[model samples]
Target: MAEISREYMEQVAQMWNARGKGLITHMALEIENVSSEGVRVRMPFNPDFCVDKDQTLLHGGILTALLDSVFGLANFVTIKGISSMATLDLRVDYLRAARSRADVIVNAHCFRKTRHIAFNAGNIWFDGHEDAEIARGTASFALTRGDTSLLEAMTKGKAS
Candidate 1:
């Protein structure tokens, strides 16, 4: 893995948090760890994401969305000079019922990257239960590389 500067990581965190009024913002994700190798994020238990009246069992759609979002973050950290990226393909598997009130933890990494594409994989589980993953996902992203990065485009409102 390449060494990622702390300054760059902080910028990424700030950009992620600054995303206003969207599913990502509604998810209220927190970055726990970040590096060229991967990223770990935590999503606090949200009753709004639950389908059941009890709010203990999490909806599968939420897990899928979480994985997709984290996979994008993983690609952003690992791939350089990307002006924009879009999900080309996504596959998710529900390993088991997500029936916990505990926060959800997701770890994702970009395993492959080329000039125009990146591949990512990740797994999610309730906090403190690493042995039991509730969901796993893999995705491919179409990347557009340019002098201005996605971070710059987002933070500065620069056209890619």
Candidate 2:
């Protein structure tokens, strides 16, 4: 493995967050922090995402998407440049429903990296309660070296 450039790592972080800028743009997810070890993202709450209007519960699928994206990103940052990776498996346990109208934060870490795959785990919590998690998940991704065109294609295809 070659030495990972600090500048390229920052670019990868920006690119990873850009993945969420399309359809999920409404989710208002932002990259809170990034490091070779992990990535953290914040998804601001929107009333339109409420699954239970009366209780103001966020839709479970949104959390799943958040986990999936962060897991892939966690894997991406471990590499040198723009790379392609896909989630092979993702298991999410919703410990509790997220509080609506409050921002949800997710922190995902790439715990293990093999020659062709990366393992990741993450936790989600509403703003101001990072220790009290609402959900946790484990994920694995199939890793490959390539330009970001594949990611662009995937994001565009999903947007359509």
lDDT (tens digit, per residue) of candidate 1 on 63-110? 999998999888886677888899999999999999999999999999
The regions of model 2 sitting more than 4 angstroms off are 2-6, 19-21, 146-160
Kindly provide the TM-score of model 1 when superposed on the true structure, using C-alpha atoms.
Answer: 0.93
State the weakest 10-residue window (summed lDDT) of model 2.
151-160
The C-alpha local distance difference test score for the whole of candidate 1 amounts to 0.88
- C-alpha lDDT of candidate 2 relative to the true structure: 0.76
Q: After superposition, how far is residue 27 of candidate 1 from its true place, in Å?
A: 0.3
| Candidate 1 Cα errors over 4 Å, as ranges | 1-3
Q: Write the per-residue lDDT of candidate 2 for residues 1-160, one digit (tens) a residue.
A: 6766656656766765666566456767788887776788888877777778575788888888889887877776665433567789989999886865778899999898886888899999999997789999998888776555444554565431
